[model samples]
Target: MVFIYVLAAILLLIGLLLLDYALGKKHHLKNVRFLNFESTTGEYQIYTAGDPLFQDLFQDLRHAKKTIDMMFFIVKTDDISEELLEILKQKAEEGLQVRLLLDRVGSFRINSKIIKDLRESGVQFAFSETPKFPFFFYRLQRRNHRKITVIDGDIGYIGGFNVGREYLGKDAELGNWRDYHLRLLGDIVQHLQCTFFDDWYLATGHHDEEPFPTETEGEKWIEITATDGVQLEDVFESLICQAKDEIFIGTPYFIPSERLFKCLTDALDRGVNVKVIVPMKADHPLVKEAGLPYMMRLIEAGGEVYMFDRGFYHAKVVIIDQQLCDIGTANFDRRSLFLNKEVNTIIHNSRFVMDLRLAYLKDVQDSQPLKEHIFQLNTIRTKIKIGIARLFRPLL
Candidate 1:
């Protein structure tokens, strides 16, 4: 009995040590300063108030000379999809190494003809592992929720935009979809490239031979950090906790982890003006149902919640203290926090943050306030549904 007790105590200590090490690494990366050019000079490219995201994406793809790598959760067969495919086919035909990674589950409805066409055009492709029962709980729970594209290892794009008509406001049922995507043209692009390569090799069992691009010394400095099951310290939660004065967050789904909820509540307690905007009508009813219970807590704690009435609010962004912004595909839910392989760009530029804030303001104008009365008025049946959703949120 004495030996067993000692062993248990030793195991507990080892677990604590590991947790400390993991959290320490996460904190270190969160605090790493990125050089913001706007701080030095009063000028920066803060593109807000409506920019043609697809046009920029097409231009970047058309200019790819050596390599084009892309990873996305979904790739619908739409106009944008066909245009992108044509550009990629042309690039591959020009001897450029083009690769695409799609999630098997998300793109399950995608026609096989499109895959055959791309493969016949010499574009290498692979599907992220599908969730299989009994033998693949890890793969089933953890998904590659990153939407990324890297061109020539110098230019990249990352954000919540998937390859779908709805994302570009081209779907009849999903009109005027609001989303965000960034065009990166510096050292951070390499980080995005590395992320794509890691996923590609994991899916296809082939690795790229090219050296990773080094950090480019530019006027603007940015760090791209990612989180997966491999690193389970909740990097996004840390960023939210670090917010001091204000936080403007927008996500389609807002079923937050406990750590993230505490962080936001603490920020509110510390007098941070916290505002969260979620879609009034989410594409997934389960996510919308799961998000309602948490709003009353946030509102009572001095935080504000709004539901976007403008079609679908699919973008995931957080502007912290009006100085730092994170834009990515990760939602504020258990899936993104603990299950999905998510990539978020930590931009320490005030200009970028301001731009994001402005966008949030516009989104707020288009949103309806989620008052305490709504929660009070829900019937018992609705409450039961919400309860079930909350119970299974981690799996959702």
Candidate 2:
């Protein structure tokens, strides 16, 4: 009788949580907003690893003249993060207008005491996309997955690198980390700053505006895109459907929506080269399995797939016809497409894209071609996991 009562209580609690999630998640995505897209020019340099990215970012923080603003999906508590915190603290003490916004659930491991310390040290810190009561369950999974830093008002850092040791390749399980980050110099920095402040306003109820950047000395045309989650598919679909010659995609996850999958298959049918690179080893359970069916279908359709064997391939990149490139925080997964707030920087053809192309080729060279036999479901357990992943694909 006691066991039955305990099970009943547990089930009741889950039902209440689900109800709360349904109510709270309705407004979660709508709450996050972005500035209007204004095309501009910027000089960009790509960083393929965290060591160089962080080293340059830290130095840039030290050199910042007026303000420092940052936002990230996750900020793991470790030595590397401590180093960054110390820098921000010291910079804050020096009277710089410093602000940090972290996704509440993504960085839940960061203790309240640390945040208090930052506040006391003059840093303005707040949690973004925090779930509220009555709808907490659904809202809790919604996230601000953008990673960006704007120094003073001239330099902008954007892409997948977050503040953590694992991002630095210190995790024993994931092995070396591979990603793409960009350091930008131009008016786009102002645009990034305005977007950061808009996110900050949503999180902290404070609002400020920065003017859009104008023409600069660079020849590269760029656009900063912020998505409230639902609109990303349209943007990506348009890009893919318009591809003339080839499509190159490198992402951590590959569970695309039905339309996206069809688009890729059609691209293959049109004889447009479509190549995708995914990590050989999955950092999360079932993610690799979830993509196996897609990979096999692509292979059946004459598409090429590469398994990045050198490390965890976390680069969220898409190159179309060597004329444009997208490098940002989004993955080729349903979660990114329909759930998380994302930011992507689009770069038009230039010498920069040519260099990025070379880097992409190098990454492909470091990977192994995905063979259908080696990856297709070979066991009941694997099939079961894939089945489970499919049921939760939207939340993956």
Question: Which candidate achieves the best lDDT against the true structure?
Answer: 2
- Tell me the spans in candidate 1 whose CA falls farther than 4 Å from its real position: 1-51, 132-134, 209-217, 230-233, 372-377
How high is each candidate's TM-score? 0.83, 0.93
lDDT of each: 0.75, 0.86
- Worst 10-residue stretch by lDDT in candidate 2? 209-218
Q: State residue 286's C-alpha deviation in candidate 2, in Å.
A: 1.9
Tens digit per residue, CA lDDT, model 2, 185-226:
887777777778888988888978554343346657899988
TM-score of candidate 1 versus the correct structure, residues matched by position:
0.83
Error of 1 at 12 (Å): 33
- Tens digit of lDDT per residue, candidate 1, span 29-70? 554322221211111233221237777778878887788898
On the 0 to 100 scale, the lDDT of residue 33 in model 1 is: 25
